[model samples]
Target: METALEKRYIDFDATGFSNEELLTIYKKLVLPRLIEEKMLILLRQGKITKWFSGWGQEGISVGCAYAMNEEEFILPMHRNLGVFTTRNVPLNRLFSQFQGKENGFTKGRDRSFHFGTIEHKLVGMISHLGPQLGIADGIALAAKVKKEQKTTLVFTGDGGASEGDFHEAVNVASVWDLPVIFAIENNQWGLSTPSREQFNCKQFIDKGIGYGIEGIQVNGNNVLDVIRTVRSIREKMLQDSKPVLLELMTFRMRGHEEASGTKYYPEGLQDEWKKQDPVDNYTLFLKEKGILTDALEKEIHDSIKHDIQKNFDLAQNEPLIPAAIETELNDIYAPFTQHVIAPKGDQKEMRFIDAIQDGLKQSMEKYPDLIIMGQDVAEYGGVFKVTEGFVDLFGKDRVRNTPICESAIVGVGLGLSIAGMKAVVEMQFADFVTCGFNQIVNNLAKLHWRWGENADVVVRMPTGANTAAGPFHSQSNEAWFFHTPGLKIVYPSTPEDAKGLLAAAIEDPNPVLFFEHKYLYRSLKAEVSTDYYTTEIGKARTVRQGTDLTIITYGLGVQWAEEYLDQHSEISAEVIDLRTLLPLDTEAVYAAVKKTGKVLVLHEDCMTGGIGGEIAALIAENCFEHLDAPVKRIASLDTPVPFAVPLEQQFLPKVRIDEAVKGILKY
Candidate 1:
């Protein structure tokens, strides 16, 4: 709760620095300010799209980066240009990032400060702002789990403090006792809103009291204060294995971005803050300390400006990202364990839930870097007890029970993935995925595609209806993440496929969403594989073959299709089970359509925007010449799962598949 400036570097010797280190600090503080100025010129010249100014806040960015070890990471925001420079990320590549050039870190995939390269140990921010805090928690977790001597620092603005992710992430970090420094640059304004309207607390650092972590406030305009404070708390954070929230108090001397002028600024406020400008203050201190002279200062300025102009000019003329399907879509997922592991033998009959648990268990045994986290997955054994007895087998360190913060946990998984850990996060129910959608869609889904950074994480989504669990608990929501490009979706029907595909999902390098139907958890049973095995993610299984018709389905739909055929044995049908949704097995689908000359698409999801629609389109577009009849889709009515048994039966797509099958035959 300490809000006052505990230490100030007034005199030259007060900073406790030799001349050489002081000069380095001065250079670091000056570089970002100059970069901002140069980027503004580029913006005005129509060379770049936009730029966020770090005009007065260089001290916080520079000092924190300078204080940390080279291997320790900083999840930075747009204004933390000093972080990239201090980390020695090549200047040419950094400028190319701004120019949307192929030579950039992200291969021109992202033009904003939204790219992270593991080589430099620097991950940038997403526009959402708050989720990165949890990612920092994961990075710290990796260092702790590996027993590496490292600490992680993350940056956020005053405005970012209000986001629910901030609360959730900080709490997760504190509860886990992670070695993280949550550095908040209190720059007095977020866009046009001042700090007065953001919060009523004495200062933002006091917000840390609820989490029971130490809070420190420093004068951000004084580079020495930022460096010293971060240095002072880092050991404490590491030794105690806890987080520290450091609030850097400063002013935004300019508008948020270059184009948005400070027209909303209070009169005379910018002028007053100008007096405490970090770059100017640091330069004056260095000059007075005899660490810098007029000639030396000019030499430093000339050197940096020359470096900036050379890099910027080269980046300006660099080749733009190619305009082609192959180049644009390449590297959506990093290389993974694609070779399937052959099963040893068939085990005794087991329920669908047991198969899922078996897959997760086998995955843990196979990969030592794997960690399983969810709401109750540890000692409590998850909501459905899917991970029951896992903590004792795997130990508590690996089987972690997470707080009910869906968004932050997902972000944490992403961090773990970046730090080279295979993370499995089980959502209590798939419907709660809405709470963490941004992290899945934006952070986990995009990182590998963005920079070839593997997101080796699996989100086990317990989905589907028919248990009368009502709207919240009984939603078949795999379709929600299906439309996104970077995520892999798997929906298995039989217990054997569930075990194999779940194993595949965990082994895959990209972020995979494994949707397990809640209705099938205990209702379905089969003889599953006894040994660890992985089914190819994008392949389809032809469960039943017939010449008369083709019925393509997955998950609960597979059971329904078979049940319909059982009731009416007259209809000869070939049922193809699409175990994976993302990389749909187009070849198998086309082959089935070609053979039957009629296709019926069935799924448990609602009619609109369902996987059925995509299957129908693929048939219509690819097999138009071979088909004798138009493709038909059967699905549940577009509504939330109902509470009443009668209503739930109507909402489920049981009888409709039979009707759709008969209708397709007549065509």
Candidate 2:
């Protein structure tokens, strides 16, 4: 009773391959093995620092690489040496990368397996597992958007399947039906842990079903079987314009890397797997089919060995990277010069919700390339009705209504942004962002740092607690992103500031995590300007002038401080709203702290790792001498925001103007 999936793979085995094809498979396996062994020797001799052998999984890598055009893109993992080698990455450069030499693909900055060459059409390998899947989706989507003929193939491990990124990437690829292939190398182990222990599911291919994508499990040890199956699947994918998942059932004969040993593996598992070695098994199959004579096989092996030795020698003699390379790389994170300044004269007032809507309208009108997307945002005006009339105004394409997959929503936004579109993806609620955290933190946040100014995306999330919307609906996770690098964080308290700051973020050539306060959406109103406007990204705004105390806050905290100041005119508290936290307005903060000589940091997030601590540390280190009193912090308690109205209220930051005023007055 074999299922359709199993039957497809079984049929692949019966498909006949020519003698030349069999010989080609044997050559592919031998070449990769020789290179891997040479690198292993280099690792042992301390010439190569690390190595992850594709010893047992060579057949599948070779088969998939051969099936696709060399011009098509590939996002590989650390164990994808076979694919890279087969794609024509020079062996000398590959070995040089391992030895940390200038001849390396990344000039020795990256590990050997993480090497990539634009000329070879192979995108660099990501050391972190599963992230390549999202990158592949982006590359594939870019090709589709640009009407390019090329497709993208991404590799991952069976253990990587358990990670949230795997599900996120697959879901987005399926929804978009992008020309992409997700090849999973089910090597039976995730480091020391067995795949069976990592997941309860019997088949890794079944996981793809949840995302509404086609998937197949193949005998990866069988070179022809793998090649035939992948070829058919890829053809169908390109014709139908869809994503397909191929789970290659394979084994790992070597340790996780050069540093790890297989002592913890199950008894006799390695011995049992050795019987099905892809290279040896494929060579025997070739000989049985009369495709490979002993003399020809020996000649191929000898040539590969000699070539590997020659490359290894060249790599060992390659020079080191120059000091200037490191110095040039540091300038990527330098402060932006085209800063947005505060509005001249009196500040315009507006409701926070209307401010957000106005900001989107202004940004969209300013940049035709800017797109607004999220669940129910196009027609339904979003969950909070903030994007009301956007679709009617901008049409369907610009204001897209997406499916309920948060990860896909964010991933697609990132993809679109990288493809030269300014995308503003809304997460209906702040709490729902947990589903797309990996896309935000791993892909979007790290993309610019990894590639340098190539990936600029903006993610707008409406967050904060106050609506009695239970534990699942209420959350303040700004701290999670405030600490993450390669991102611009903006949380504005006023409608005017929201509109101004969001416009600035959309125009800036960087990825931004724009947080819109849910409770402040329409709580208040003011006269917003009809003219286009943008505020500075990292600079803070001083709302009041006072000498006694400095209150540093953003978003709702700024509103709370304003309210607290209204009640205590005697204290004369100077409130500074830090609209952007990542590229923090340290200049404004230090100046304000110097003027007041006393500081109190406030935020809606939990105390631990909150932006408050970061600001406190900055003030303590730079402005410590001017401080007349210790810096105090006011934040939510360290716990999940509860559903109970009383508990939720208690969880919020308590602002006692009298106490703060009296305390700072004494100093």
For each candidate in turn, the TM-score is 0.97, 0.84
lDDT of 2 by residue, 175-235 (tens): 7778888898999899999976899888877877887888899888777778888878877
Candidate 2 residue 325 Cα shift, in angstroms, is: 12
Could you tell me which 10 consecutive residues in candidate 2 have the lowest summed lDDT?
A: 1-10
* lDDT value, residue 534 of candidate 1: 86
Clashing pairs counted in every model:
1, 3
Model 2 residue 566 lDDT score: 86
lDDT values for all models? 0.87, 0.77
